[model samples]
Target: MKAHNSKKVIQYSYLFHKIGILDDEQYKQIEEYHGLKEKKKY
Candidate 1:
């Protein structure tokens, strides 16, 4: 269950990153804040 939620978060983050909504640093900060273990390789 937790893994599913994390995957959704990652998907949203990736979409935001691609759309220029969030910069690289901001994305990293969000991932860190969420304690995401698997970092997406832009």
Candidate 2:
């Protein structure tokens, strides 16, 4: 539905803006940490 898709777009934009505040180094570190956690879980 159009409304459902619009809601998803808003959520994605919100997340993007939230992460946009972080510097690239911080983002990469967070990503790496999550990757390690995922590997451990598997």
Name the top lDDT candidate.
1
Q: How much lDDT does each candidate structure score?
A: 0.74, 0.57
Tell how far residue 38 is off in model 2, in angstroms: 0.5
The 10 consecutive residues of candidate 2 with the worst lDDT sum are: 1-10
lDDT of 1 by residue, 1-42 (tens): 665677678779979999999999988886785555544422
Worst 10 residues of 1 by lDDT: 33-42
Task: Give me the runs in candidate 1 sitting further than 4 Å from their true place.
Answer: 32-42
Misplaced by over 4 Å in model 2 are 1-19
- Listed per model in order, the count of residue pairs whose N, CA or C atoms clash below 3 Å is 0, 0
Provide the RMSD of all predictions against the true structure, rounded to 1 decimal: 5.6, 9.1
Error of 2 at 9 (Å): 18
**TM-scores vs. true structure, each candidate:** 0.63, 0.51
